[model samples]
Target: AQSVTQLDSHVSVSEGTPVLLRCNYSSSYSPSLFWYVQHPNKGLQLLLKYTSAATLVKGINGFEAEFKKSETSFHLTKPSAHMSDAAEYFCVVRGTSGGYQKVTFGTGTKLQVIP
Candidate 1:
């Protein structure tokens, strides 16, 4: 079985502060982790992914995440938050051995960016 658990359902940040969103997962086989951001009424965009490759992965919009095997965690981080960064973020896990690569989305973490 494969599953992902986002530690928080919401994360708030200032316009110029750092952002952090935590996630954990468990899979029988190797897993693919991803972070996607969705702006207001906008489709979700891929932010980053970990496919049993590099542990630390950088992504667009100055966002990044690190996959820790020992801890079974993939946490998203950003040095500075912008008003534009305010959105809903989802932690996803890719399913294997299926017709299509099923992507499981987290409940969602709402990022409130205060100016």
Candidate 2:
């Protein structure tokens, strides 16, 4: 069975502070991991992806994640959080067996920004 657990359901930070959203995954095979950010009523934007490539992957908006096979973790991090960064984030894993790529999203982590 494949599953993912987000360490936090909600994260609140003031503008300019560091941000960390933790995630751990379990898979039967080599998994493709992704992090997506969605603004209210907007579509998901891919932040980063890990597909047997570099262990440390950087994405847009100064966000990055390190794929740790041993730890079975792919935690998203940013040096600083912006006010615009307030949104919902979902950790996703692509399914292997299905013909169409089925992306399973984590429950979600809502980011709250304080002025």
Candidate 3:
């Protein structure tokens, strides 16, 4: 079974400060991990992905995540938080179940940017 855990339900950061959204995942086999961001009244957008290629993956809008198998962690980070960055983030894990592809999602973390 594959599962994802987002350590924080809500993360508040200053407009110009660094942002960190913690996530941890478990899978029976090597899995694909992803981070998605959803703005208000908008669909989820793919931020970054780790597909066993590189440990560090960069995505749109200055976001990036590092896949650490030793720690079973895939945390999202941004150097500077923008007001536009405020949104709900989801950590996802993709694996196989019953020979079919399945994806497990985290509870989601809401990011709040403070001016």
Candidate 4:
């Protein structure tokens, strides 16, 4: 089993600047990691995943994240901020626990778009 932490409870960015959202994870084994976003009153949508394939994983809406095993981090980044990007983002870690698979989600980071 593994756990994840979303460093910031809320992050604010202007319309066009770079956006950085931090996340850290703990796992006994190589974990299957994923990032998901939830818009206001909307269901969660899968952003990207690290399935032991690529360190740099890209998602929809110009979002991407890098998996750093050495640091136990999987921080999400965007080149530019967008008004539509305002949402609650979650970092999820999935692994086996007690011989059964389990999933854990980080405390969500709420992205606020400012003018």
Candidate 5:
């Protein structure tokens, strides 16, 4: 079994300030994790993913995350928050169910970028 938890339901940041969105997860086996972003009236966009490769994963829009097995966490971070970054972020974990791979999403964290 696998599950994902977004530590913060909402994050407020000033434009040009650093952004941090915490996430924790658990799985019975090696899992694939992903981060997605959704703007208002838009579809979800893939940010980055971890599939047993590098611990530090970089995504578009200057977003990055580190997969920490020791801590069971994959926290997203961006050096400078942009106004366009204000959106809903989701942490996803891939698991198996009934011989099929299924992805589970976190409750989602709403990012508010203050100009």
Candidate 6:
């Protein structure tokens, strides 16, 4: 079984500042992890993913994350926050459930950008 936990339910950042969203996860074996972002009244967008190939993965909109096996953590970060970055983010984990693969999403982190 695999699961993901988002450490923060909400994150507020000033425009032009840095952004950070924390997450941790567990899996029975090597798993596929992903981060997805959603704007208000919009569809989910893929941010980044780690499939056990590279540790540091880059994504769109100047966001990136590192997959640390020892820490069981996958944290998302952006050097500078943009006003458009305000949204809700989900940390997802892919694992096996019974005989089928399952994808689990965290509670989500709502990012509020303060002008």
Which structure among the candidates has the greatest lDDT?
3
Q: Per-residue lDDT for 1-115 in model 5, tens only?
A: 7889999999999999999999999988788999999999999999999977799999999999999999999999999999999999999999887788999999999999999
Stretches > 4 Å off in candidate 3: none
Alpha carbon lDDT of residue 4, candidate 4?
Answer: 98
Stretches > 4 Å off in candidate 4: none
Mind giving the per-residue lDDT tens digits that candidate 3 earns over 9-92? Answer: 999999999999999999999999999999999999999999788999999999999999999999999999999999999999
Tens digit per residue, CA lDDT, model 1, 1-115:
6788999998988899999999998876678999999999999899999976789999999999999988989999999999999999999988765555667778889999999
RMSD of each: 1.5, 1.5, 0.6, 0.7, 0.8, 0.8
Residue 103, candidate 6: alpha-carbon lDDT: 94
* Local accuracy by lDDT, each model: 0.89, 0.89, 0.96, 0.95, 0.95, 0.95
- Tens digits of lDDT, candidate 6, 50-99: 96779999999999999999999999999999999999999999988798
Candidate 2: regions farther than 4 A off: 98-101
Report model 1's TM-score to 2 decimal places: 0.92
lDDT by residue (tens digit), candidate 2, 3-115: 88888999999888999998998877788999999999999999999978699999999999999999999999998899999999999887665545556788889999888
* Model 3, total clashes: 0
- Residue 48 Cα positional deviation in candidate 6, in Å, after optimal superposition: 1.1
TM-score of every model versus the real structure: 0.92, 0.92, 0.98, 0.98, 0.97, 0.97
Our model 2 lands, by Cα RMSD against the true structure, at 1.5
**Model 6, C-alpha of 12: deviation from truth (Å):** 0.6
What is candidate 1's CA lDDT for residue 92? 94
Clashing pairs in 3: none
